[model samples]
Target: MKKAVLILSIICMIFIFVQSWFLSLGGSYFDFATMFQGGIVGKILALLFIAGGIAIMFKPQVAMVVYFLGGAAGVLASMFIEYQDLFLWGIVALVLGLMSYLFNREEKEGKPGSNL
Candidate 1:
């Protein structure tokens, strides 16, 4: 179950990058005002949430907080962005990160002489 969430979270991140890449290419670098004027905002928010999901690999406990905050931010961002998928992806990351954290805690508790 944890692995499933982790994989899904990765896919979300990949999709976000792909979408953002294409959106970014549509504009010129010289058009500074338009760089972050639209969909890019949601992409940035999604990236932050994905980053939190990745953190679960190194620090499950810390990632818990990040995921919570990221999820909230994504929900807030969804209010004004056309890419509502950001909210979906953020919720996914939050669930996955929490699942990973719980799994890690269970594993540690099940082990002998372990301190979590």
Candidate 2:
């Protein structure tokens, strides 16, 4: 389960880049400006998602908080940008949150460095 969520997180980040490329080429069905404005907050949130996914590998507990925060930001972004249906964005957040919740388990050793 942990591995699965890690994979999904990677996929989501890739999709974000792909979607940006699609908009650049004017090949997407949705409006780019409304969703991909490259605003300060959006970029920060994007970075947060990437960072959260990376951190998940080393520390699942801390990663869960990052994932939850990222999911919340995504949902908020959906509300501000209505180019695509909010339901889809909500689903993405829901999946991230669910996966994080399902896969999180305490490491046997303290903080991965105490003892065997």
Candidate 3:
């Protein structure tokens, strides 16, 4: 579980960072146009998800909430964009959520006052 969580989290972070690079590269051949069409607010939200991914690497607790929100936002945003593999985004989100849940579950199990 830990290995899965680590690998997925790293991928999310890498994706986020790569997005910023894509932004600098004029976003040709990439699906940046649709996201930009979402306006400044949407861009900001997307950036938040990227930031959240980075934070997750350092702070799993906060990352869990961020991941949940990011996933929800992605699902909603997908309705407006024409991405090729949007379903994969949802699956990634599901994987992240499950990983975080499993990791937390084990942590709680070892603590005296845990709710698990």
The residue pairs that clash in candidate 1, if any, are none
The global C-alpha lDDT for each of the candidates, from Candidate 1 onward, is 0.65, 0.58, 0.56
Which digits, one per residue and each the tens of the lDDT, describe model 3 over residues 1-116? 54556666567655644553454344444547764443332344445555555655566666567667666766676677644233345456656765676677676688997763
Which 10 successive residues of model 2 have the least lDDT summed?
Answer: 82-91
TM-score of each: 0.66, 0.62, 0.59
Model 1 agreement with the true structure over 1-116: per-residue lDDT tens digits: 44565566667778877766655555436454343343576567557656666766677676677667767766676676555666776676567667767867886898998963
- lDDT per residue (tens digit) for residues 1-116 in model 2: 66666677677766655554444345234545664443333445446556667776777666677767766766676677632433343356456666665556445443575464
Query: What 10-residue stretch in candidate 3 is worst by lDDT?
Result: 36-45
Model 1: ten consecutive residues of lowest lDDT: 30-39
Which residue pairs in candidate 3 have backbone atoms (N, alpha carbon, C) closer than 3 angstroms, thus clashing? Answer: none
Residue 21 of candidate 1: its Cα lDDT? 61
Q: Give the TM-score of candidate 3.
A: 0.59
